[model samples]
Target: MDSLEQLNQRLREGVRCDGDYPPVPGEGNPNSPVVLIGHSPSGTDAQTGRPYSGPAGELLDELLAEAGVKREELYITNLVKCWTWREENGLRVNRTPSAKEIKEWVPAWLKPELELIRPKAIVCMGGPTAQHFLGKDFKITLQGGQWLELPEDSPYLKLTGHRLDPKPFVMGVVQPNYLTHLQEHAPETYPAARANLVADLLKIKRVLEGKLPKPKAPKQEELDIPF
Candidate 1:
């Protein structure tokens, strides 16, 4: 089995991938009870060589503290390991990763990382991260904050060879960057957005401590909202 250090080395080396920016591996304790998965790194991540190190990261830190969780105690990573971007008007603008990129990278890189960490609960921050583990039709706006259980036979686990000893709890939330955007452009919605994210983080703490019931699969009717 590859160790976390080995995985980080692979990511830093940019082995087996092609992208303008070098891969940014997840950071924090490998055995952390909770794992945070984001969409992808931003240009700031490329410069700082850290996941969630930009404005989004700053807000995330504040939210983590509000939830009484230390940044060092949780494993943090991204769905796409690198900073995806495009040159526009002489500036590098971050872009959402294409589905093809996610499809290719998850199995080869993210899956193995999950297998190694084997977190008891996964907090997927943003649409891509949620959809990758949940389902393509997952809409964070409608289902955010609802806990969903990942069973032993879940394709995610089966693909990563994760053990069923501790069934993982998964929850979705809006991306921190999106929340920041709201704070800037849609000021009216910022408070509600931040509150929802804080609530989700607190729920994660409760789930980790067994203070709450394991999340059940959502009913089909519950998930019928337009994406």
Candidate 2:
């Protein structure tokens, strides 16, 4: 899209899975050097007409602040633009988006959005979101902290419309949503999970300060003709 407003407008004008709610577009500085992507929006996001709302959002703000990252300067979006929620126990809860939904929203909505933002860093907040760009086998526990270059041939480029040289640094992190999940279902692990998320964000902070460099892109090999 030519403008962030156009991008948001496209979503609002046509894109709809749950038409009952307004689409939540990526917000913050459209040209931000950093972008934080979540899997999907929560019910609160629908209500607020923004991404990252409710309890998870509160913790996300605290974590970003602790990590010296300002949400105001970073663009934030989701893998899916809409809130993928279903009624359960008389309350709404986020649900796993179907393959069709992922195909419809992610490649089309998130791709051009990233192109417009042209972020230097892309932080995929959850495992599924990470794997969508990274390989399906990516494991956050092992690779979450590492800053890897998005290869020129990366499907991410085609999927997310990232074409700049020395493509954006990609890092996976335990989502704040997961932290809330830990708090509710696995209380003992919440502290460590929270700590790790902060540590990852701190890396991003250092990257922005020119103190830490992301891994360089791989060089292409030359062909030799012995004839």
Candidate 3:
């Protein structure tokens, strides 16, 4: 994991894939101080072999532009590198990885990525993702956009089995899909939520500018693993 080349080679050579879809290795600055981790790939991501695509990608691009951030300046990837789905009513639908699936994949896929990039901060794209590193009851409405640290036993760290010294700080933000949904189905609430999303996006810039203080790991109490 000394380089992105080694990481991607491991992903391509040693990693097992169901062969329905291959792992979507992260794209962007290999040494970025921030990484955006999603729960898993969407249908479009699987099809295009990219992390964000279609509506979600569009919204993310626009938000990055508005926040005065460039995509190439940040690393982006999903916790689960490949896509997961189930068939229902004669249709194929996207689904989150099961606890079992996550257990099987994360150490192999995500651990090394973090080890290589060593981002100083991460943005969890949605509640479930936020919960992965933060705890289950980490209320996004109350805590999003604030400086925080992952618990010592945070799933991302433990599952990856790699402890980054002075571990990367954490922040939570609304997923693009949620914002898109809000815009389409709940217009009344969309404006306020979208504004919050923009503010959260800007925090990345503040972090890079050395304006926000790095968070120390909060005291450990029993916290729910968001399986």
Per-candidate TM-scores read 0.86, 0.86, 0.88
What lDDT does the true structure give each of the candidates? Answer: 0.76, 0.76, 0.77
lDDT of 1 by residue, 1-227 (tens): 77988988977986533455667889998878788998778888887889999888998999988987788888999878878888999987888788777776778888888778877888888766777677766677667788887644454554556564466778878877777787788999989878878888888677556565458565432443121
Q: Write the per-residue lDDT of candidate 2 for residues 1-227, one digit (tens) a residue.
A: 36888878878888655758888888888866778998888888988978997788888899989999888878889988888987999888888666677777877888878777777888888767776767655667666767777655555555656566436788878777777777888999889878877988888777666564546333333431110
Q: Which stretches of candidate 3 lie over 4 Å from their true place?
A: 13-19, 212-227
Judged by TM-score, which candidate is best? Answer: 3
RMSD of each: 3.0, 7.8, 3.4
Per-residue lDDT tens digits of candidate 3, residues 69-103? 88888999888877788889987677877778777
User: Which pairs clash in model 1?
Assistant: none
lDDT of 1: 0.76
Q: What is the Å distance of residue 155 in model 1 from its true position?
A: 6.6
lDDT of 2: 0.76
Candidate 2 residue pairs that clash: none
